[model samples]
Target: MGTDVDIALLVKELCHHDAETEWIEFKTNNSDAEMIGQRISALANSACRLGIPTAYMVWGVDDKTHDVIGSSFRYRLEKRGNEELENWLHHQLTDNASFEFAEDVVCEKHVTVLMVQAAFCHTVDFERVPYIRVGSYTKKLREYPVIESEVWSRITKSDFESIAAKGGLTLPDALSLLDFPKYFDLLGAPMPQSRDEVAHYLCDDEIILRQDDGRYAVTNLGAILLAKNLKDFPTVARKALRLVQYKGRGRSEILRSKDYEGGYAVEFESAVEMIMALTPSKEDIIGAVRVQTTAYPERAIREILANALIHQDLTVTGSGPVVEVFSDRVDFTNPGTSLVDLMRLVDNPPRSRNQKLASLMRRFRFCEELGTGWDRIISSCEALYLPAPKAVEYEGAGGSVRISLLAYVPYRSMSLRDRVMACYWHACICFTNGETMTNKSLRCRFGEGGPSSSTVSKLLATAVGDGLIKPVDPETAPRYMRYVPAWA
Candidate 1:
């Protein structure tokens, strides 16, 4: 429906309220920008206290009789000194609360409505002072310390996804800004015939919130996953995934780099494809023809990239997930330390800082549904006889986790640490699949050109000596012995 029709319905609903509310004010030709600013703060704070998502001030309505009389107010044309009224109010508000004005004809009279989102994360302040509504009167928030504290407490507990990325959008504006068709396609649902049904679905999925003023607000979840251009949402524009290709194994010489501008889901496949394309590959003769082989398995790369995006801390500002491709390794780093122990990721249940983002990515089949992502990466490495990937966590404020996929290294040239890690990861993968690592299995992972049986045994002994893996049965024959992860 058009904005005009929606505005008319909203006006009717507001008129039906039995009494004037703390969250709503009726005025006629009250064009004072300073007074409007105070009401905005008071109404926004009151809405939070009452657990309401939005508050409003409507003009062209009779204050006592609730009648829609024609208004002479022209908010769009109002100016304070040299600045527009809208811009001035925005600069004066402390909470960054999104408030917008919309004008339409209601009851055959011109009516203007100002919609204000409730205080979230901070109390709304105008001109350096906070305000709140008390029995329909606007008063300084400091005069009511108890109410101010309650607002702060409630605001801090809000979910990150509920925060507005962009506000005051009409249905058409929202549809144009987000890739709505792709959203339904990912969910495996047929498109609804009516536009209203589409809007309802988006709101139900928490992608967009329907406002009291008949406008729409894009949630962080919606913008992160479906925005056509992330730049439209300034709060999350910098959260776009980054990919860098280096000339060698260091950050000094960057070969190529890109910052994906679209939402994660929209740009995911293309990003993976680009990463694999930049990956080093060689030609190998298989039976009669030469086949191309990549330094890392494409399956492993996909899982790693998806995990980095899904598990990242969305609250972290200024940084996002990054994939760096060196000549010898690919490192996937994201802005959050691992919730699962680095050593036990193969067996631990999946934990994510952004659960909603993870769930949606899984629904779209971009990542694993079970906690087998790490297991698959390990197994793929074993299949190709490549060295096992390493996962490390950096702890502290602004800490992050990085997982590196290394190129194949000759067994004779591998370091002791590399050999021990290979054994531990093999045991981990085996234990996850209800099996244990044996000498023969370990040798198979090293391929046919690998070391002798005795050499493999020595490596296993070294791994055991380093407390990386333990024998399942110490009493078992040397040739028949099986090893499992030490923590198993």
Candidate 2:
């Protein structure tokens, strides 16, 4: 069993199963390094072939009786060659292939569990040979030509989003399972009066496909974007969005939380509304009237939320896109790391892991077309005089992409880094528009038009000193000088 209590329960549950599945295997106290490596490779490949996220190799359990017989295996401390066992395993496996070993005590018996992530986009190999699990036995993949071919096809040809959420359902059942009305509403099409017509519409969109058996298969795309209740489809319920609000700057103080369960299109509006309500706002007095403005720009928040939803990795189980609100900022974190470099987010074309989902969200007007969302967020923040939002990739186990929208901070209160970043982003935007950063433009960005030109020059010089921007013509007169980002 692993360090997590849930993993311990998972081990017990697997042991209770009548037999080992294609993605699950049992091992005794045998800790032969080569054998363990081969098993890990086999489980990983088998899991990919079976379209599962992870495969399990549980120790301390009997194969035949399915009994918890305790394992003395301590592979973590074992060594192969001059390297540790884990390091040796890593060197043998394909790129991005990973596995974890956990130790626990169950009912006074020591147990070790190995959790292997499925090979993705490539087949996993050990000692220059790919292995797979056939029933409960591990063997060289090429030994079974038929299975080898099938596994390779699965690896090279399959798209997770295109997989059917629920296969072999009747036309009526498929229609009943999804919210056709909302789909039509989002698409700006009138609802069909008949079930047959609705089924035809869904089929046309590839949401459901007609099978030879006269049944329909609901694709993951359809279920995730328009399912009546995402929970009805077990594989996608974890993809639902969760919103949490804290009482203060840290998470120690709890306020409120909600896990949105509706489809993305159905729940997006309400989720945004809830977030805006929880977000603090200020009262502004115009010349003759009063206005209420939120702590963060609504348009920027909407774009960030949509990006998180459409760009998340649907295959990651156990977690999904999360919106966490603290006193000073709102954080958007999704299950997968960004496809594009965080530093290039402002100028690079948007890259999404889920292209189909992105296309649909664009069609529904949930987000803009490719590459414009970040620009919009930046410009919106600039227009509001708010600090530019931050985008970063949190690197670790189950890595994620996070975007934070900081609360409104006056330009006088901004830090040196903040000023440099704002100037750099302003230059990026200007260069994108075929212009250059000037003292006047920089002053306008900070809403400090009354400041002397020399004062503005100091800010620009500070940016240049930090190597964030450079003068286009160093010898040009100060009054005629223009600047661009250092990389530009």
Candidate 3:
């Protein structure tokens, strides 16, 4: 499945493995179509059961002596009745089974190889009966119920990120498909002088796996994080961030939209820059020149965007992270609900469905300190005297999480739910800082032009009535009352 160089290396490597291995079969010139189909099913199932990514069948090698004797097996010219050898075998196997055959000259002899992809979501079957390799012998899967069960269990626990997004790549193709420079730059390492050295690093990181055939397999994690163009990998292409700008606050009217086609690491900065450009800003006069300041802090937007990409549930097909820019607020929505309690997101340690993605992004400096993203978003908003951001989880069909960052809204115009949420988030921030929320502090949160002290006090009372916050000391005077999050 790789280049000629790959085939030569593979032939040499296969000679080293024990012929009794379940995932490998060696032959000198046997070209029986039916037997080959059965071997394909057996090898695929065995590979899956053994946690191997690929299975192999090599021709032109002595099974006992592992000698490089040329074979007359020309799979491309063979026929099964009126059907081509490859076509007939493909039709006999289950839809989940995949294989390819290659013929090349290696060790000065004619060599042939049949490469089979391991069964992933389901066991491979030929002729409507599953088969598996047992000590170099092919047998019916039903004869071994325990192995069948184990294969099913492995399928059930398979990780989407670990699956190959695309396979059968040469060294140059693999390097060109990913933003290799960005990857090394993120780690603050200089690019290696040799391409193979670069590949060594990628393989060590589990980004690109070196197949037994000397080819490369680009994993879903690598493609999602570093692919030069996501379109090259169909599985993760739909995972790219989609940004939509509305003429107003609702979705009915469309202004403009864009779907970033690069990997998360490659397009993160551009996505944030686009959002900031669409964000509402106000002009403020200083001593000399006027400065334009965005309503939402750039850091807050960047952090939330990164969170969305890192926390999204990759199992949810056909959906990805989305950014909706409205006149008054920006919403960052991903394809999964929060793993932690909604109320505890600010203080709880970070939990993500894609820990590998999160860890890599953190290493790239795209993420805030572990568990401090929400804290930073909250603190940034508070510094601008802006209404607190809200994190909501809509549950169902693997659920979803949406983080909404609001622009400045007057206290009087804020709905009761908005006011209560603001109070709760404010208390959460104060509690996280080892302090408690107070009337004067709440007033300052709303800025000097906010309503009177009594208005802030009434808002705090509403939050308490809603059980989102509680007085730190019940016996304290009303003027000196302080509050912490209800759970705190």
Candidate 4:
């Protein structure tokens, strides 16, 4: 049954108890929405403090009187747009939990139940940041750095697979629908002749688990990689690949669309292939003839696709992954926000929420090991003179993560500042034995009308004066001008 259904049944139990215990409580008389949200947050926070899977807030019992008054406040009025209420509580509670809300009746009296599931292992960012409730007041999470530290510490130490999802299907049920032959083909391996052997092989791969019912269940790990269709799992179906096309600059034009819906590990190759098909080609001279080539390199496509597949939040429902294709640029946005700070994305090691998903995809050769994805993505773009794909993270409401590549040559937009930046970097790429930059080489690096004989010397003098670059050569004979990584 869905969390929605379990919550309804759970509410009935709380109402029947009619007593406020340490963990069980009722709000009979008060119907204020803010009051509703606050108490729910309290109960949820209290539930976390007690290590219980769930906590209840029911109507029909008094708060101060501790007597059964049975709530008369309109709960029907509560569900109208109270998603905002739940959402408010959500921001205050810092966990990625399935926690749901429902209404039920006992003794023919109206009662509302907020069934808050356990706090998820990792820190859950709400409104793009974490929050905490103190007594009844909501406060920024960073205010209580202890709780923040505790939560963050717990998150990094937690394993992806071992996180709790009670009543979440066991591994067997999840794997039953998988197509093993497809997996074998992708791996370039022979299909096992016997069912027992096939199942055993999958278990060894951690793709399937045998449940107590003597049936096999697929782990989310297995299903995401091998399911014939991801849609079967309503919670995490078809959140892959949204492509948006534009006619002009900055997502202005409306051109085309697509959403890839299949096991990502199984279908990532197909997704990347479609993206390649979508990218436009440019003709380049080859001796006396000309050949067409894609504006962005194939390695860029592979890296972005790998980034989308590996970093998505599987727990988020309804919203799936998306890739937006513009006439001049391609914007790849995933539903979950980034874990690391934006500055560190291109430098820090690779981290992921879905360990099993990332692991299986690696074995399938979708990408190389961690920490290298950024290196590959960045180097490929810089190598081709395409501005490196930019990593953008949006943290608000539902939050979003995006990688934007300026696909079109930004001839007009390449202002003087940009040209200078590009020149400096290009020169840097060629110096220090192919590892640094120099003022003289910067002009040659862009398009080969080597800087004027005197221009190179003047530019070098200015660079040294500005502390932007240092000249290693003192002797000016042969107009010597070599440079290395200044930061190095």
TM-score leader: 3
lDDT of 1 by residue, 1-488 (tens): 12323566667777776667888888999899999999999998888777666677889988788899979998889999999999999999974556778889998999988878777657789998889988778899999989888778777776566666766567887778899999899989999998899999989888888876567778889999998988887667878999999998899999989999989999999999999999888999999999999888999999999999888877677789999999889999998777888989888987777777888899899986689999899999988888889898887767899999989989998888888899899999899889999999999988989978899899999999989899999999999999999999
Model 1 residue pairs with clashes: none
lDDT of 4 by residue, 407-476 (tens): 5344344544444434444444454234555554554443333346465555555555655455566574
Taking every candidate in turn, the Cα RMSD to the unseen true structure, in Å, is 5.2, 9.8, 5.2, 8.4
Candidate 1's displacement at residue 446, Å, is 2.1
Cα lDDT listed for each candidate:
0.85, 0.81, 0.86, 0.58
The number of the candidate with the highest lDDT is: 3
List ranges where model 1 is wrong by over 4 Å. 1-157
Candidate 2 vs 4: which has more TM-score: 2
Cα deviation of 277, candidate 2, in Å = 1.3
Give the clashing pairs for model 2.
none
Q: TM-score for each prediction?
A: 0.78, 0.72, 0.80, 0.60
Give candidate 2's TM-score: 0.72
Candidate 2: where are CA atoms >4 Å away?
Answer: 1-140, 145-150, 285-289, 448-455
Candidates by TM-score, descending order:
3, 1, 2, 4
Which model, 1 or 4, shows the larger TM-score? Answer: 1
Q: Which pairs of residues collide in model 3?
A: none
